[model samples]
Each structure stands twice: as C-alpha cells, then as structure tokens.
Target chain A: MTVIDVRNLRKEYGPHVAVDDVSFSVEHGEIFGILGPNGAGKTTTVECVEGLRRADAGTLEVLGLDPHADGKRLRRRIGIQLQESQIPERLKVWEALDLHSSFYDTPTDWGRLLDDWGLAAKRDTPFAKLSGGQKQRLFIMLALVGSPELVVLDELTTGLDPQARRDTWELIERVRAGGVTVLLVTHFMEEAERLCDRVMVIDAGRVVAVDSPSGLISRAVPEQRVRFRPSAPLDERLLTGLPEVTRVSMTGTRVEVSGNGDLLHAVTSVLARHRIVAADLRVDQPSLDDAFVALTASRPHGSGGSPGASEGASDHRRG
Target chain B: MTALTKYELKLFLRDPAATLIVLVLPVGIVALFGVVMSPGGGDAIETFFPSAAIALGLGQLGMNLLPSTMAGYREKGILRRMAGTPVHPAALLGAQLVVGALFALVSMALVVAVGVVAFGFGPPGSIPAFLLTFVLGVMSLFAVGLLVASIAPSGRVATGIGVAVFFVSIVFGGVFMPVESLPAFIADVGDFTPLGAFMRALRASWAGAWPEPLHLGVMAVVALGFSLLSAKMFRWE
Candidate 1:
C-alpha cells in the first residue's frame, strides 16, 4: 500500500519558489529517500508531506488522508523529526518522552523505548547535557513513542561523527524492521544508497529521477572500468577487438579496459588466452555518488521545466 | 494538555535563577520594606510597599521573563517541532501562560503571608475585589509580554524589548514611587497605561474599596487588545 502520495506539489516563499511541481510516493514498510543538494526543496517537499506547510498547488495524501484538510488526524499516525527542531534544553530525557507520549492516543511504553534506544542510562540527563549522538537517539525514541505507523526523519545524522552516523543508520533500519514505513530526507548519497529501498532525486524543486540505489547507478552510468597491471607486454588490438571492450589503453605496464556487459569476464578470458598474469586487478563499478552527480549535473537549466519531465523521458527510453 | 503544563512547570523550576527571581525577589522586597515601614501605623503609604512588591513580581514574570522564554521556544524550533505532532502549538502557549500564572499566584501568596504574619500588615481590605484586580493585572501584563514575544525575531531581541518595556512600565506605573507624589499630569497619563491602572486597582482593593471603572476598563482593554494581536502575529518557526 502507498503510505504517502504527493503529486505536483508546489510551495513558494513569496516570489521564491521552494518546491515546484514535484511528485513521489512512499510505499508501506519501506525506506524511501528524498536525496538532493541544499536549497533543492527536499525539506520543503517533506514539510508538505508532514502537513507542516500548506502546498500552494498539489495533492498530498498520507495513509489515505489529505494532509492539510485532515492534518490533526494525520499527525496522530505519522511521527516527524524535523530539521533544526529541538526539545527544551532543561527538559530531562524521560520527561520529553513521557510528555510527547501523552500527545498520542495510543502511545507505546516509553520505558521500553528508553531501553530499545539505549537511553536508559541517560534518562535523568537534561537535553542540553546529552552528546550529539545521545540527543539524536532520544529524538528517534520520541518519534517512536507515539507508536506511529510512519516516521519522517529530516537530515537525522547531518552533524554526527562517522560512527554516530553509522549507528543512526542502524537505528533507522531497526525502525523499518518493526514494519513502520520511513521517509528519509538526506543529501548524503551513501546514506540513501545504504538505507533507502528507493530514492527520488530532486533538484531545483523538480524530480530528476526515482529508482533503487543500484538501479540509479546503472541507469546514470551503464559502463564499468577495469584496471590491472599485466605481467607481460600486451597488444592493444586484442582487447580493442572484443565485443564487451569499448576502449583499452596502456599506462606503462598497467592496462585500463572500459566497457559494458560482461566486460570483466571478457577481459580476464583474453588475459588467460595470452598467458599473461593480471596483477593488482581492480574492478571499479560506478557508485551512487557518481550516479547522483551524473543525474543532477545532467539536469537541464534555464526555463523552469515541468514536474518529472526528464524522469518520464528516461523511463520511456528504459522501457 | 495537563502533561504539557506539568513539564513546562518542571522546566521553569529547573532554572534556579528564574525561579529565584520570580519568587524570592518579591518576598524579599516585602520583607525588607515591612521591617522599615512598621505596618498597622495607620498610614495609607504602607500599602505602597506590598502593592509595589506584587507588581514588581508580576511585571518581571510577564514582561521580562515570559517574552524571552516564549521567544526562545520559537528561536529553538520547539514550537515548530510540536506543530508536527497531534497537539497544536497553541497548547504549548497555553501551558506557558498557565505556568506563569501559577508562579505569579505562589509569589503573591508568599508576599501576602510575609506581610500579614511577620509585619502585622492588614489583609486585603476586600478579598473578592483583590482577587478580581489581581486576575486582571496578570492578564494585562502577560498579554503585553505575548505581544513582545510575537514581534521579536529572536530570544535575545525579545529579552531586550521585554527589559525596555519592563523598566518603562515600572517607572510610569508608580512602582518606583507613590502615584500621589507624581505630577498631576503624569499621574493622569499613568491612569491609562496597563501597569499604571493595575497598580491603582491593586491599591484601591487593598484600601477596602472596588477599583475605579477607568482602571478596570484600562486593564480589560489592554488585555483583550494585546491578546488578539499576539495571537495574530505569533509564528511557529
């Protein structure tokens, strides 16, 4: 079932358009990522989905309820961890959880949440005293205390250390494991690649593409490169003539082969026939970071485009 | 809503400095002055000490502290965070008002206790009139504080504005001196101001009479007007 459905969502700040004609849907029980650079309207888009902002033009349905019209009811079932939002500095950890739980009709037990989120030791600590990671954990715990069916986490790990980011990712995965749908907004490609079941790439308030991590990588960059140091002198023509080998270049004793479709097998089989050992072999497949750069960079500029225009054309070609 | 108010009360108490200022300062004022004045001397000027003490406490809570705290909540995005939940941000605002009122009442009680028991100062001349005037005074002062909170862009700015307004109100409202000694024109002008009217009404009730209609009307008008303006201007973020 679709948990969140937003179509042609447009929001503006006076003359400055923040989100323009964006469209996407999050499926139930899956982590959906909205990936974009700063000022790309990622936060504005989710703010609409969370029913915090009224879209100037568009339709948004969360759990089959209109977000703006049924906001009070919608808010009950969806937990939100907003960017730059904070608890009172003097409020204790347990008090925040207990207080927020009272806002929901059927809240989960906060004591268990404290244990689950590893915050039991810090229960008495004031919010200002917690380290960044602990504060983040408490926020996630508060988000879950409402027993929500879906949670919207906006830049949850933006300021954390690398270890804390990894730990937060694991916690997010745990949230999904409990059958709650998650909508994660992030600019980090690795985060989306690791945790998102599918990602919607938005740029300049427009939808660039929507696909799984690997799907995006493959779609944006179809070719892979293989680098190896050959033990013996190699003929350039032998690799150039192969069907999978699009280009082959020699750098000193190192051979670089680039192509699509069975390129590794094709090049390795050729090396075997020549009886030349391929040393320090490395297969460099394009990563999500590469795909993100390629997709956003290739977007057309000037003359504001329609929502998902390029996404539609790309889908047609893929089909 | 009760949970929100309880937590808000806890948060207020956690700040020892603020709690001390709200409770200790007023009681301390009454204590210091009660010793010097030698109450029950049958001088009406004795009323100035207790009334000024209570007014000072309310002004600090409503004018200096409340605006800064509420603005800080907006500056820190606490209000915005609550907006995403099942509860409205207005509930938080209401909780703050409730907490502030609670502190004001406690502080007033402490001032009265110290005045009546330790100094032999008489109780309010009319209990019902005193209560009515007290309620109006709190509403008017807090309404002005909410207005300050609404217009200020940040917590620091709100604190600056609150302090400025507080000093001005205390000076012109007769907290610094008895209104009877001020210039006739100044006293007349003070009658129209919220704090000025509040002090007069409080003094009237303590002297065993109902507050003047002009004083009551001034407090009511300021309370209603500022409340509506703040509600219209308040922002979640």
Candidate 2:
C-alpha cells in the first residue's frame, strides 16, 4: 500500500520558492529518504506532509486522508520528529515520555520503551541535563511511543559522534524491522546509503534523481577505476587500446584506468596477457557521497525550470 | 488532560519564580502591611490588607507568571512539538491556566490564613459569596494574562509586558490607597478593571454583603472578551 502520495507538491515562502513541483510516493515498510543539502526545501516538503504547513499547490495524501484537511485523523496514525523542536528544559525524561503517551490513545509501555532506547537510567534526568545523544534517543522514543504506522524523522543524527551515529542507524533499522514505514530527511549521504531503500535527491527545491543508493551512484558516475603499480615498465597503450577502457593515465611507474562496465576484469586480463604483473591493485566505484556531489554540483546554479538544459550539457560532455 | 495538568502543576511548583510570586509574595505583602502600616490595627487593617493581598496575588499570577510560562513554552517550541500529536496544542495553555488558577487560590488562602493568625483579621462574612468572587476574579485576571501571552512574541517580552500590566492593575486595585480615598471619577473607571472589580467584590463579601451587580458584570465581560480574543490570537509556532 502507498502510505504517502505527494504529487506536484509546491510550497513557497513569500517570494522565494521552497518546494517546486515535487512528487513522490512511499510504499509500506520502506525506509525512504529525502536527501538534500541545507535550504533544499526537504524540511518544508515533509512539513507539508505532516500537515504542519499548508501546501500552496499540489495533491498530498497520507494514509488515504488529506493531511491539511484531515490533520486530526492523520496525526493519530503518523508520528513526526521535527528538525529542531524541543521539550521544556526542566521536564524530566520520564515525565516527557509520560506526557507524550497521554496524547495517544494506545501508547506503548513507556518503561519498555525507555529500556529499549537506553534511557531507563536517565528517565528521571531533566531535559537540560541529558547529553546530545541521550536527548536524541529520547526524541526517537517519543516518536515511536504511539506505535505509529509511519514515522517521519528529520536530521535525527545531525550532531552525534561517530559511534553514536552508528548506534542511531541501528536503532532506525530496528524501527523499520518493527513493520513501520520510515521517512527520513537528512543531508548525510553515508547515512542515507546505509539506511534508505531508496532516496529522492532534492536540490534547490527540485527533484534531481530518485533511486536506490547504488542506482544513483551508477547513474551519476558510471566510470569505475582500477589503479596499480607495474612490476615492470609497461606501455600505456596496452590499457588504452582495450574497448572497456575510456581513459588511462600513468605517473611514476603507476598506471590508473577509468571506464564503464567490468573495467576490473578487462584490465586484469590484459595485464595477465602482457606478462606485466600488477602490484597493489585497487578498484574504486563511486560512492553515494560522490554521486550526491556530482548530482547537485553538476547543475548550473538557478536554472531549475528548464530541466533538459543540464541534461544536454552532460550529454555533450559524454559525447 | 489530567496527566498534563499534573505535570504542569509539578513544573509550576518546581520553578523558583512561580513559587516566589504565587506562594510567598502575597503572604509577604499582607504581613508587611499588617504589621508596619497598620500599627493601630482595626477593622480597616483586618478587611483591606487581606483583600489587597488577594488582588496582589492575582495580579502577579495573571499578568506575570501566566504570560511568562505560556510565552516560554512557545519560545522553546514546546507547543510546536505537542502540535504533532493527537492532543491539541491548546491543551498546554489550558493546563497552564488550571495550574496558575490553582496556585492563585492557594496563595489567597495563605494570605487569609496569615491575616487571621498574625494580625487577628476577621474572615469574610459571607463564605459562598467570597468563594464566588474569588473564582470570578481569577478568571478575569487570567484572561488578561492569556491575552498578553498570545500577543508577546518571546518569553522576555512577555515578562516585560506582564510586569507592566501588574503595576498598572495593582495601582487601580487600591493596593496603595483605599478606593474610598480615590477621586470618584477614577474609582468609577477602576471598577471596570480586573483587579479593581475583584477588590470591590471581595470587600463586599468581607463586609457581609453580596457584591454590587456592576462589579460582577465587569468581571464577566472582561473574562469572556479577553479569553475569546487571546484564544484567537494564540499561535502554535
């Protein structure tokens, strides 16, 4: 079932456009991500879906109900953790959980939730007293207390240490494993690559691409690389002559090859045939981080309306 | 709603400013005046000091404490966070009102107790009328506070406006001088203000008479008008 369907979504802040004709649909049980840079309107788009902001144009439906028109009904079934929302500083962790529980009709047992989120011992600690990671863990617990079918988490791992971020990623996976569809809005490429089933890359209020992590990487930067130091001096034409190799360069007795489709197999076979054994060979495929940079940075700034302009430019470059 | 109210009450009690304003200040005001100002204490000290204490407490809670709490919640995004839930954002305001009114009543009771124990002041002659007047008085002042909360953009601004209103309300309520001592025209205008109307009704009940209809009507109208306007003005963000 499509839990959320947003078509031609448009929102603007006065003269400046925030979300421009954005559209996407999320199926049940998929950890969908809206990956974008700062001021990319990722938050605005989700706020419209959460019914926190009214969309200026377009059709949005969540759980088969209009978000703005049926906000009360939608709020009951969906949980939202806003980007920078906060509870009272003096409010204790347990009290915050208990108070949020009162807002839902059938809240999960808060005691168990505390233990699961590693916040049981800190339950009596005030919000001001908790560390940043502990506070984020509590926020997640509050988001899940109602056992919502769909949970929207925005920038949940923004300011955490490496280990803490990894732990939060695991927790998010656990949330998805519990049969809940997750909508995550984040700028972290590695986080999206690890958690998202598919991602919609939004840049400057426009959809750049929508695909799985690997799909986006392949679509953006298809050239895979192979680098090695030659055991003996070899001719560069040996690599450049191959059909799979698009570009080859050499420096200081080391050679590098970049091409599309099975470049590793092609280069290794050629090296084997030429009796030039390669040492310290390394293969590199573009990461989502690389793809994200290419996807967003490739656009000529402020040219969103004419979609084919950038596409044509890239085509010219490829040709 | 009960759970929210309980938590809000806990927060109120735990706050040092709320404790000082709602619990300690009123009692201190009554004691200060009863001992120092009314050395040759008589019916006037017994009646006027306790009434003034109630007015002072209401002014502090309604204009200062209530608005500050509401604006603080909004400033810190507490209301916005709660807006995502099935619970209405107004629930926080409602809980705040409940807790503030509760503390006002407690403060009034303590002032009355101090008046009796410390200065041999007499109790209100009409119990039922006193209770009615107290509830009405609380409603009127809290409504004004809610209006301030709804309009102030931040906690600091709210506190500033609240204090400004507090001084203005108390001056007209005859905390500095008896209403009888004020010029007739000023007293007439004072009857329409929350603290002024409250004082008139409280005095009447203390003197063993039902409050004048005009004073009661002023409270009703101000309470209704301010509450409706503030409710409309309040923004979750």
Candidate 3:
C-alpha cells in the first residue's frame, strides 16, 4: 500500500521558494530517503508531510488522509522527529517518554523502546543532563512510542559522533524490521546509500533523480577505473579488446584500465591468462557520494532552471 | 488531558525558583505586612490590608507567572512537539492555564491562612460571593497574561512585559495604597482596571455583601475580551 503521496508540492518563505514542484510517494514498509544539500528544501518537504507546515500549492496525503485538513487523524498514525526539537530541560527521560505515550490510543511499551534505542540507563536523567547521543535516543524513543505506522525522521544524526551515528543507523534498521515505513531526510550520502531502499536526490527545490544507490551511481557516473602494477610487461591491446573495457593505458610498469561494466573482472581475467601477475590491484568504482556531489553541483541552463536539475529529466531508474 | 496536566504539575514543582515565586511569596508578604503594619497595640488587621494581600498574589500570578511559563514552553518548541501528536497543541496551553490556576489557588489560600493565623482576621462574610468574585478576578488577570504570552517573541521579552504590567497593575489598583487615598480621577480609572475591580469586590464580600455590579461587570468584560484576543493571537511557534 502507498503510505505517502505528494504531488506538485510547493512552499515559499516570503520571496524565497523552498519546495517547488516536488513529488514523490512511499510504499508501505519501505525505508525511503530524501537526500539533499543544506537549504535544498528537504526538511520543508518532510515538514509538510508531518503536517507541521501547510503547502502553498499542490496536494499531500499520508496514509490516504490529507496531512493538513485531517491532521488529527493523520497524527495518530505517523510519528515525527523534528530536526532541532527539544523537551523541557528539567523533564526526565522516562517522563518525556511517558508524556508522549499518553497522546496515543495504543502506545508501544516505552520501556522496551528505551532498551531498543540503548537508552535504558538514562531513563531518570534530566534532558539537560543527557549527552547529545542520549538526547537523540530519547527523541527516537518518543517518536516510536505511538507505535506509528509511518515515522518521519529529519536529520536524526546530524551532530552525533561516528560511533553514535552507526548505532542510530542500526536502530533505524530495527525500526524498519518491525514493519514501520520510514521517511528519512538527510544530507549524508553514505547513510542514504546504506539504509534507504530508494532515495530521491533533491537540490535547490528540485529532484535530480530517484533510484537505488547502485542505480544512481552507475547511471550518473559512467566510468570506473582499475589500477595495478604488472610483474611482466604486457601489450595494452590484450586488456582493451574486451567488450566491457573502454580504454587501456600504461606508464612504465603501472597499468590503468577504464570502463563501464565488469571492467575489474575482465581485466583480472586478462591478466591471469597472460600470467602477468597484477600487483597492488585496486578497483575504483564510483560511489553514491560522487553522484550526489555531481548532481547537486551541476546547474541547468536557460531561465528558471534548478541548480540541481539533471542533464535529462525523468531519470528515475527504480530498483 | 489528565496525564498532560500531571506532567505539567510535576515539571512546575521541579523548578524551585518558580515555586518560590508562585506559592511561597504570597504567604511571606502577608506575614511581613501584618508585622510591619500593625506593630503597635491595635485592633486586629483590618479588611483592607488582607484584601490587598489577595490582590498582590493574584496580580503576581496573572502578570508574572503565566506569561513566562507559556512563552518558555513555546520558545523551546514544546508546543510544536505537542502539535504533531493526536492531542492538540491547545492541550499544552490548557495545561499551562491549569498550572497557573493551581498556583493562584495556593497563593490565595496562603494569603488567607496568614491573615487568619498571624493577624486574627476572619473568613470572608459571604463564602459564595467571595469565591465567585475571586474566580472572576483571577480569570481576568490570567487572560491578560495569556495576551502577553501570545505576542512576546521570547521568554525574556515576555517576562519583561509581565514585570511592566505587574507594576502598572499594583500602582494603579491601590495595592501600595488605598484607592481613596488617590485623586478622584485616578481612583475612577483604577476602578476599571482588573486588580482594582478585584480588590473592591473582594473587600465588599469580606464584609458579607454582594460586590457592586460595576466591579463584577468590569471583571467579566476584561476576562471575556482578553481571553478571546489572546486565543486569536496565540501561535505554536
């Protein structure tokens, strides 16, 4: 079932347009991600989905209900973790969880949620006394206390250390394992690549592409480079003759082969046949990070073009 | 709603400074004034000073306590957090009003207790009349505080506005001096103000009579008008 559907969403702040002509949908039980640079309208789009902001134009529906007009009904089924939200400084962790639970008709067991989020020991700690990671865990626990069908997490790991961020990623995976649909908004490309089932790359109020991590990488980045030093001198045509190999070059004992598909495998097979003993072999496949930078850094031409508009529209290769 | 109110009360109790300002200061004021004003061998404390004590407590709560609490919650995004839940953000606002009203109740009780114990003062002559006037008076003052909370951009600004309103109400409403001591025109203007109307009506009820309709009417209008205006202006920012 489709959990969220947004069409032609548009929102502006005075003269600054935040979200313009944005459209996307999330299926049930999918970890969908919205990835973008700062000021790319990612938060604004998710805020509209959370019913915190009214869209200036277009339609938004969550669980088949209007997020704005049916906010009361929508809220019961969707949990939201805002980017910079906070509880009272003196409120204890358990009190925050208990208070948030009271808002739902059938809340999850908050004690179990605390354990799942690695916040069991901090239950009695006041909000002000907790570290940044503990506070984030508390926020996540509160977001799940409702046993919501859909959880919207915006910038959940912005300031956490690397270890804390990895822990949060695992917690999110557990949340998804429990059959909750996740809508994650973030700028961290690796997080999106690892966690999102499908990501929509947004930049400057426009979507550049919507695809799986590998699909995005392979499509936006057309070439991969393989580098190695050969034990014996070899003819360059022996590597370039393969169908997957695009080009081959050699500088003294070092060889570099660039291609689009199965280039590393074909090159290794060629080296084995020739008994060349490729040493210090390395394959440099393009990553989602590279694709994100390329997508957000490039600009479209003509009047009213988005800064992140892809070279071609309709580049949605869903996997 | 009950759970929200319970947590709100807990948080309020946890803040010592707020507790002292809201619950303890009224009792202190009543005792200090009793000792200072009646040092010599004199009759029991008169009705005026006790009534003034009540006004002081109510004004402190309405102008100082409620605004800072409401604005602080909004400034910290507590209201916005509640806005995303099945419960409406209005629940938080209602909870704040409940907490403020609870403080007002304690302050009033302490003021009366100090009057009875330290100064040999008796209960108000008509119980129902006193309770009615007191409720209306508190409602008006809290409504004015709600208006301040709605407009102030930050908690500090709200507190500043609250202090400013606190001084104006005390100075003009005869908390420092009896209205009769002021010029006739100033006293007439004071009669329309919330604290002035509340003090007058409460004193009349202390003497065992229904308050003047003008005082009750003024309280009613201020209560209704400010409540509506504040509700209109309030934002979940």
Candidate 4:
C-alpha cells in the first residue's frame, strides 16, 4: 500500500522557490530516503508531507488522508521527528515520552519504549544532560510512543559521530521491522546506501533521480574499473580490443582497464590467453557517493530557479 | 492537556531562580517593608508597601518570566514540534498561560497572607473588588508579555525587552514610591498604564474605597486591547 502520495508539490519562500513540482510516493514497510545538498528541497518536501508547512500548489496524501485538510487526524497516524527541535531542558527522559504519549488517543507503553530504546537508565536524566546519541534515541522513542503507522525522521543523525550514526541506522531498521514505514531525510550517501530501500535525490528544488541505491549508482556511472599488475610486460592493445573494455591506461607497473559490461571477465580472459600472470588485481565498483556527485553535478545548468541558476553559473565559471 | 500542564508546572518548579523571583520575592518584600514601615498605624500611604509587593510579583511573572519562557519554547522549536503532533500547539500556549496565572495567584496570596498575619497589615476592605482588579491586572500584564513573546526573535531578546518594560512599569506604577509623591505628570501617565492602574485600584481596595473610574477603565482597556493584539501577532514557530 502507498503510505504517502505527493504530486506536484511546490513551496516558495518569498521569491525563492524551495520545492518545485517535486513528486514521490512512499510504500508501506519501506525505508524511503530524501537525499539532497544543503539548500536542496528535501526538508521542505518532507515538511509538506508532515503538514508542518503548507504547499503553494500540490496534493499530499499520507495514509489516504489529505495532509492539510485532515491535519489533526493525519498527525495521529503519522509520527514525526523534526530537525533542530528540542524538548524543554529541564524535562526528564521519561517525562517527554510520557507526555507525548498522552497526545494520542491510543499510545504505546512508554515504559516499554524506555527499555526498547536503551534509555531506561537515563529515564530520570534531564534533556540537556543527555548525550547526543541518547537525545536522538529519546526523540525516536517519542516519535513511536504514539503508535504511529508511519514515522518521518528529518536529519536524524546529522551531528552524530560515526558509531552513533551506525547505531541509529540499526534502530531505524528495527523500526521498519516493527511494521512501520519510515521516511528518512539525510545528506549522507552511505546512510542512504545502507538503509534506504529507495532514494529520491533532489537538488535545487527539483527531483534529480529516484531509484534504489545500487540502481542509482549504475544509472549515473555505468562503468567499472579493473586494475592489475602483470608479472610480465603487457601490450595495451589486447585490452583495448575487447568488446567490454572502453579504455585502457597504464600507471607505473599497473594496467588499468575501464569498461561497462563483463569488464573484469574480458580483461582477465585476455591476460590469460597471453600467459601473463595478472597479480594484485583490484576491481573498483562505483559507489553511491560517486553516483550522487555525478548526478547532481551534471544537471543541466541555468534551470531558471535562483539556487539552481546561481550554483550552475558558479560551476560553469569553475569549469 | 492535563499531562502537558502538569509537565509545564514541573518545569517551572524545576527552575529554582524563577520560583524564587515569582513566589518568594514578593513575600520577602512585603515582610521587610511591613516591619520597617509599621503599616499597622492605619495610614493610607502604608497600603503602598503590600500593594506594591503584589504588583511586583505579578509584573515579574506576567512580564519578565512568562515572555522569556514562551519565546524560549519558540526558539527551541518546541512549539513547532508540538504542531507536528496530534494536539494543536495552542494547547501548549494554553498550558503556559494557565501555569503563569496559577503562579500569579499563589504569589498574590502569599504576599497578602504574610502581610496580614505576620506584620499586622490590614486586610483588603472589599474582597470582590480586590479580586476583580487582580484578575484584570494579570490579564493585562500577561497580554503584554504575550505581545513581547510574539514579536521577539529569540528568548534572550524577549527577556531583555520584558525586563526593560518591567522596570519602567514598576517605576511609574507607584511601586518605587506612592503615586502622590511622584511628579504630577508622571502620576497621571502612570494611571493610564496597565501596572499603574492595577496598583492604584489595589491600593484603593485595600483602603476600603472604590477605585477611580479611570483606573478601572484603563485596566479593562489594556486587557482587551493587548490580548487582541497579541492573538493577532502570535507566531507558532
């Protein structure tokens, strides 16, 4: 079932259009990620989905209800953890969860949530006294206390350390395992690659691409690179002649072969025919990080929007 | 809503500095002046001490503390977070206003009790009139506080503006000295201000006489006007 359906979502701040005709839908029990750069429209898009901001022109439906018209009812069924939001400083851990639980008609057991989120020991600690990871855990727990069918987490681990971020990723997976759909907004390529079932890359108020992590990498950069040092000196023409091989180059003793389909098999087969032992071989598959850069960087310049136009102009100058 | 209000009250009590200023300070002021001025002599000017004490507590609460707290919530995105939940963010605002009013009432009662029992200060001549004036005073003063919270960009700015308005109100409201001793123009100006009108009416009720029509009119007008203006200007985030 489609959990959230947004079509032609557009939002503007004064003269700046923050989201421009963006559209996507999140399926049930899937981790959908909104990936973008700093001023991209990722947060604005999700904020519209959460009913925190009104769209200038669009139809947004979460769990089959209009976000703007049925806001109160929609809120009860969807949990949200907003970026840069905080509880009262003096409020204790359990108190925040307990209080938020009261906001819904049917709430999950907060005590169980305390234990589940690994916050039982810090239950009495005030919000200001909790560590960064602990605070994030508390926020996630608060979002779940209402027994929501879907949860939207915006930049949930933006400032967290590497280990803390990995831990949070696990927690998110657990949330999905509990039969809830997750909408994650993040800028971290590895985060999207690891947890998102599908990612929607947005840049400068426009949708760049929406695909699975590996699919995005393949779509953006179709080539694979294989590097090996042969025991004996090799002629480069043999590799260049293969159908799978696109380009061949030499760096010191290593022969680097770049191609698209069956690249490794073609290169290794050619080396085998020559009785040349291929030693210290390395196959480099393109990562989501590379795909993200290629996709966002190669966007058509001067899209007319202020942010995109300015960024495009600067890139043009730099080039 | 009850859970939210309960937690808000807990947070308020947890701040020792706020509790000290809002609750204890007024009682201490009333006690100190009652001993020194010997208000039991039944002179009308003696009423200034206790009435001023009550005004001080209410002004600090409705002006200095309430604005800072509400603005801080907005600055911290607490209001925005609440807006994302099933409950309206206005529930939090209602909780805050209810908590502030509770503190005001308790502080006023403390001042009156300590003044009458421990220091032999006279009771209010007309309880109903005194109650009416107190209610209006709280509404008007808190309305000003809401306005401050509505306009200030952050908590620190709200606190700065609240404190500045607070000092000016206390000075012209006869808290520093009886209105009779102030320059004629200053006293006349004070009668039109919310805190000043509140103080004047409070003193008159304490001395067993009805307050002037102008004083009541000023308080009523300030209450209604400021409340309407604040409601129109309030921002959820």
Could you tell me every candidate's TM-score relative to the true structure? 0.96, 0.90, 0.90, 0.96
Instruction: Report the error of model 1 at residue A70, Å.
Output: 0.5
Please state the Cα-based DockQ of model 1 relative to the true two-chain complex.
0.89
True contacts kept of 2: 0.76
Which 10-residue window in model 4 chain A sums to the lowest lDDT? A310-319
Which of the two, 1 or 3, has more TM-score?
1
Off by over 4 Å in 3: A228-257, A269-281, A300-319, B39-45, B180-189, B207-214
Backbone clash pairs for candidate 4 read none
lDDT per model, in order?
A: 0.90, 0.86, 0.84, 0.89
Runs off by more than 4 Å, candidate 4: A303-319
lDDT string, candidate 2, A1-319, tens digits? 9999999898888778888768999999999999977877899899999998999999999999999999988898888898778898889999999989888888899999999888899989999999988988998999998879999999999989989999999999999999999999998999999999999988767778888998888888888999999988888898889999999989887898999888999999988998878899999978998888878775545433332212322211110
Compose the digit string of candidate 2's lDDT tens values, residues B99-161: 887888899889888877786677788999899999989999999999999999999999999
Interface C-alpha RMSD per candidate, 1 decimal: 0.5, 0.9, 0.9, 0.5
Give each prediction's DockQ, rounded to 2 decimals. Answer: 0.89, 0.71, 0.69, 0.89
Q: Per-residue lDDT for B1-237 in model 3, tens only? A: 998899889988998877787667767776777777663233333567778877887787788778888898889888888877899889887997898788888778888877777766667889898899989999999998999999998789999999998888877787768776777877788899998889888888887889999999999999999999998999888
lDDT of 1 by residue, B37-137 (tens): 78897588878888999999999899979999999999999999999999999999999999999999998899999998998788889899899999999
Model 2 alpha-carbon drift over 4 Å, by segment = A251-254, A277-284, A300-319, B37-42, B176-192, B209-217
Tell me what TM-score chain A of model 4 achieves: 0.93
User: How do the candidates score on chain B by TM-score?
Assistant: 0.98, 0.93, 0.92, 0.98
**Candidate 1 ranges with C-alpha deviation above 4 Å:** A300-319
